[model samples]
Target: MSPDFLLLYVNDPDASAGFYGKLLDRAPLDARPGFVMFKLDSGMRLGLWGTETVKPAPNAPGGFEIGWPVGSDADVDQMADDWAARGISIIQQPETMGFGRTFTALDPDGHRLRVYQPALRP
Candidate 1:
């Protein structure tokens, strides 16, 4: 089966939802005190759940990153700049790597968000 949804442990779902809403340029499809969700253009759903209330409490918020891919190296750079202007914390500047040009940023909950442009395959 394919995974179409991702759930993240957050200190505050509402707040995280707002951060993600602005970053993704989309509103949450469902939002409550302990949980919030967004539907993406790729048919994927992102869910933010309150850390204090999760059944199996998570050890931390940023064990993994949510990776985003863009069309071109310029697009990756553009997005990084846009997010920086929006007051988003950019922990890494855009740089070309083995995979492509990429940058890393942190969300309110310290979750790593990586935006990249893939290098051409052989």
Candidate 2:
């Protein structure tokens, strides 16, 4: 089955929605006090839900990261600079990886955001 949505347990859904709205340069499809959702260009849904309202609360300070792929190395660098200018904490400086150029940043809730460009295949 195809993955349709990703839900992130956040301390405050409204605050997280505002942060993500600016970061993604788009408005949420559904924005409520306890929940928010954005429909990405790739047809995937990104959701934010109030942590305290959910049952069996998810572990805070999540360990996994969400990745965004760009078209080129320059795009990766540009995105890193943009995010930094927007006050998004840069956890890792832009650098080259085995796959391509990349950088890492953190969202307000400490979720890892990785931007990268894939290496060309032969």
* TM-score of each model, paired residue for residue: 0.96, 0.94
Candidate 2 overall Cα lDDT vs. reference?
Answer: 0.89
Clash totals for all candidate models: 0, 0
**Residues 71-90 of candidate 1: C-alpha lDDT, one tens digit per residue:** 99999999999999999999
Which predicted model would earn the best TM-score?
A: 1
lDDT of 2 by residue, 1-122 (tens): 99899888888888889899999899999987788999999999999888887777778745658899999999999999999998999999999989889999987788889999998978
Native-vs-model 1 lDDT? 0.92
**Superposed model 1: Cα runs more than 4 Å off:** none
lDDT of model 2 at residue 83?
Answer: 90
- Predictions: Cα RMSD each: 0.9, 1.1
Residue 88's lDDT in candidate 1: 95
Off by over 4 Å in 2: none
lDDT of 1 at 26: 88
